[model samples]
Each structure stands twice: as C-alpha cells, then as structure tokens.
Target: MAYSTTIRRRRRTRRIDRAGNPAAIGRWLLFVAGLVALMVVVGGITRLTESGLSIAYWKPVSGILPPLDAEAWQRTFAAYQATPEYRLVNRGMTLDEFKSIFWWEYVHRLLGRLIGLAYGFPLLVLWMRRRIPSGLKPRLLLIFLLGGAQGLLGWFMVKSGLVHEPQVSHYRLAAHLLLAILIFSLLLWTALDLLEPRHGSRQRRWRAMAMVLLLLVVVQIGLGALVAGLKAGYAFNTWPKMGEHWLPPELFALKPFWRNFFDNAIMVQFLHRLNAMLVAGWCLLIAVSTWRFEAPPRTIAAALALLLLIVGQIWLGIVTLVEGVPVAIAAAHQAGAVLVLALTLYFLHMNRRTAHHL
Candidate 1:
C-alpha cells in the first residue's frame, strides 16, 4: 500500500512539472512573434507594391490555394478588374502584370493563414495537455482573438479600396497596422514575462518612464502607418527639411484643421518625422535617467539597448524616406519599428516584475 501511494505521488509530480514547462511556452510564444514580425514585413511589401487590393474576395479557407491554372488566373484577374483599384489605377494592366501584383497580396494573405495555424495548433495542444499556466490562459486567448480581428481588419481595409476609391482609407489602414503591432507587442511581452526567472528590486520612477516610452513607440508606429497609407514618404524625398522649410506650406492646409493629420500627405509625413524625433528624445531621457538613478544592471542594459534600437530605426527611416521608400529599406524600417517596440515593452516588463516583487 505504501509503495503504491509513493508511485502515485511521483506521477502527479511529473505531470505538474510537464504542465508548467516555461521553456516550451516561451519558445512557442517567440516563434509566433517571429511569424508576426514576418507578416509585418510582408504586409509592408504588399503595400509598397500596390498589391493589397488584388484579391477581390476573402475566402479564409478556399483562398489558401492561389490560382493553379490559366482559367483560374483569368477568373482572379477578372475579379480584380471589377475593383476600383484596377479600374482607376491599374487600367490597361496586362494579365502578366496582374499576376505580378497578385502574388504579393497572395503571399501576404498566405502568411496570415500560416500564422494562425502556427499559433493555434500549438496553443490548442498546450491547453489540452493542461500545460498552459492558469493565469496565462486568458491572456493567450486574447492574443488569439486579436489575431482573428487583424485578419478581418485586413479584408476591411482592402474592401475600402474595392468600393468607391482606388485607394484604401488611411484610417482603416492605420488601424490594421497598429493592431498588428499591438498583437506583436503583447505576444513578446508575455513570452518575456514567462521566461524571466525571478523579480529584482523595483525602480518605480524608471518603470513609469519605460511605460511612457512604450506608449510613445506605439504612437510612432501608428504615425508611420499613416505615412505609408498616404504614400507621403514619396513626396518629401528629403531629410532635415521639407523643401527648404521645416514645415511645408501644404501642411495643415486641409479644412477642419484636424483632417490634415490623417488626410494631408505633407502633414502626415511631417508629423511622422516629428514623432520620430519625440520618440528619440524620450529614449535619450530614459537612458540618461537610468544612469543618473543608477538603476539595476538589467534595467540599465535594457535602457541602453532601447536607445540603440531607436537610433538605428531613426536612421533607417531617414534612408527609406530619402530613397523614396524603396521596398527593401522601407520594409527594414517597418521591421525596425517592431524591434524598437519589443525592446521598450521588455524594459517595461522587467521593471514591472521588480515592482510586483516589492
């Protein structure tokens, strides 16, 4: 009887150990985050190539397989021809030209499907095995829901272009891009939180600063999305000044005054540049404050890393703008925004962990 009881206890211990495997969960989250990052880069390319409206319909399942034959390709192209994008902008485009644009949108949608599988399959398995921490289950589920919303939002943005106008509504475009960034940020933060072994001493002031910086990073990302949606970068094509003036004459020229922020290309581009400077300044403040306060080694390291990322991202943005938003440089700049946000969130998470312990 005693031997049997001891074996039962050991089995339960093993089950408990397996259920709370931090390394496995952390790695899974990181993998999902990577896919999200790739999706962002691919989405950037799709936007730059003007291929977003190529797919006239959104078939979550059937859409997986692209046009496999000439007939199907013709049908797909026909549907695209019905949309305003083709009618207004791509009029006179040939079948071959249509295929060129179609592939980018196809790959972008395909990546989204792949991300859903990569995230859902592992998540379901973990949940079934009771491996996910009870506290984390709801948060993980929220991320999954947010991912689904992003998919729907993508179609909504495309639909905008399909309707009356040849271009997508900048508002919907910004929403879609910001949602993607938010999802990425959450996944990364959750993974890092789980991976952290223990809490250190909290720096309340530093924590607050990190949180503020994280918010600023997100806002900057939204501004960038606006710039992309408006195709504003193509107009300025200069650094430091917009045609010999810090603020161009066309900036805020729109009626209602506020419309300029979202609808005015010159204003949108100028604001994006302005926000970049603000984010850089905030990052600098954090780095200097970290040194002044003599923050924990980990906090100090995160601050320095955040500063470095901000600098690199700013430089990339300048190059992308100066070069008229070339595909490669613009994509890198978009990815750099992801990296910057990731570091800022990581720093915030670290500080919060310490605060919780205190």
Candidate 2:
C-alpha cells in the first residue's frame, strides 16, 4: 500500500508541473517582446539623430564596441566621410558630433545582437531539456530566423542612403519597418500559442476581424517610416490638412504616377495621413464588436485598450509632425507605434483564447 501511494503522489507532482508549463513560456515570450520593443525605440533614435549611416559597415560580431582612441576614431570618421550622406548632408562635421550619432546607431545594433543571443540561447536549453513541447519547437525556430532576417534588413535599409541619395530610400525604410513589425507580431503570436487558454465566448469571426485591423495598422506604420525617411514630415507641418488643402495639388508632380508614390514626399505623406484615418475607423469597429461579445472581461478589456492606443498614436503623430519631428517627439511617436502594436497583439491573443474556450 505504501509503495502504491508513493507512485501515485509522484504522478500527481508530474501532472502539476506539466499543467502550467505554457504560462511560463508565455511569460518568457512576453519578456522577449519587451526587449524587441526597446530595440525599436533605439532604432528610431538612430534614424532621428541621423546616425544610421555612421557605421558604414555591418560587422555583426566585432562591431559592438565603439572606438576608444584617436586612431580608431579617425578610421571610423573617415569611413563615414566617404559615404554620400556625410559628404552631402553633414559636410565637415567634427569627430565629437560624429561620435554622438555613432553611439546611437552602435548601441542600437549591439542591443539587436544581444536580443538574438538572449532568445536563441535559452530556447536551445529549454528544447534540450524537453521543456518546450514538440509542437512549439518549429514555431520558435521560425521566430528566431525572422529576427535574424530583420537585422540584415536593417543594414540593407541603411545602406541605400549611403551612396547617392544622402538619405535612405523610402522603400527600403518601409521594408525595414515592416520587417520589425513582422518580428514583433510573430513573437506575440508565439506567446499566445504558449498560453493555450480555452476559447472564450466570442465568435471566431470577431477575432479574425480584430487581427485584420491589427495588420492594417502595422502596414500604416511602414508608410509612416517612409515619411520619416524622406524628411517629409518637415514639409507638411499641418495636420488633417496638407498645407491648407486636404491633399496637395502637386501630388503627382513626379514624372511617373508610380514615382510620386515612391519618390514624392507629398504623396507619401498623404498616404500616411489617409491610412491613419482608416486605422482609427477599424479600431473603433473592433472595440464595438468586442464589447457586444459575451467573453471574459479581460478579453473585452484588451480590445478597449487597443482602441485607446490607436487614438493616442494618431494624436502623437500629429504632434510630431507639427513640431517638425523633433528627436524626442519623433522617438516618442515611434515608441507609441510599438505600444499600439503590442496592445493589438494582446487583444488578438485574448481573442485566440476566447476561441479555444468555446
């Protein structure tokens, strides 16, 4: 009887350990998401401070440390001066000024590298120990690869401006921003997968609709990056109206219609403005749909939070544009995008939970 009782107790302990493993994975995923958010803010600073083109090379392994001596500094500064961005835009900038922007971009890249390690190392150990379920291992590996691709895309975006444009190409900038959003979305999705809560009382269609709105908002943010890349915000300082008219008369001034959308500042800024309106409308609709659902209070609450974030992001965008996209305001605006994205992801996660519950 004693031996039988001991075996039963051991089995109970094992069941309990396995029961809540998903929540632990959820928490770790949340932590990685937060780290990526920090990387985004740092990246925004690098762009706003005009530091992205400072490094001039992608030395992923050995580029973490900044130059410490005069010789090292001269070599780095000379590399920057060789770039078109330095020769045309910031001609004759002193070493001290170069250092300022250099550190911003350097730190941004360093953090990105660290984040990759932080994610991969622990994930390997967890997998080895069989802590992660077989179903999740593949998904987690894909997330890591996506993160790696994002880092490469970042360098490619920066490289575009270093040749002749004196600024990164808007298309490349948009690609970079989209990649970042993609990484964040995937991370949040993986986190949701780990949390496998039972579906709540909400319909699956409602959840799918919310996910669509969330993706639209992410695409809008990519356009916003184009606006920033071309320094377009500095031109259209007025909100809701682009310099007295709802749309600029010279929208198609560029030679080809396609050129206007890709190369013309007026068109890029207009698209970003129009997208904001669409995002707001969709957010409100999602919030209303979620409100009418008979789901857990937290699920509905996440939807409401998402609505508020969208509203706040629009307001921040206006302020940043009006203020000439000052470094701090611009950084805040970028950070706000991440915040709204996170909340939207959180709502989608809850929606998935609701679906499972049913």
Off by over 4 Å in 2: 1-20, 199-201, 292-296, 353-358
The most accurate candidate by lDDT is: 1
Tens-place lDDT digits, model 2, residues 1-358: 9999999999978855644488788778878988888988998898888888899998987787778899999999999999998888899899999999889988999899888988989888887776776667777888989888888888888888777877887778788877777777777777766666653434686678777877787778887888888788877898778998986798999996788887788898898888888988988887777677555677668778878888888998999988888899889889999888877776776665343310
Write the residue-wise lDDT of candidate 1 on 209-229 in tens digits.
Answer: 887888788888998888888
The global Cα lDDT (0 to 1) of model 2 is 0.81
TM-scores of all predicted structures: 0.93, 0.89
How many residue pairs clash (N, CA or C atoms closer than 3 angstroms) in each of the candidate models, in the order given?
Answer: 0, 8
Structure candidate 1, residue pairs in collision: none
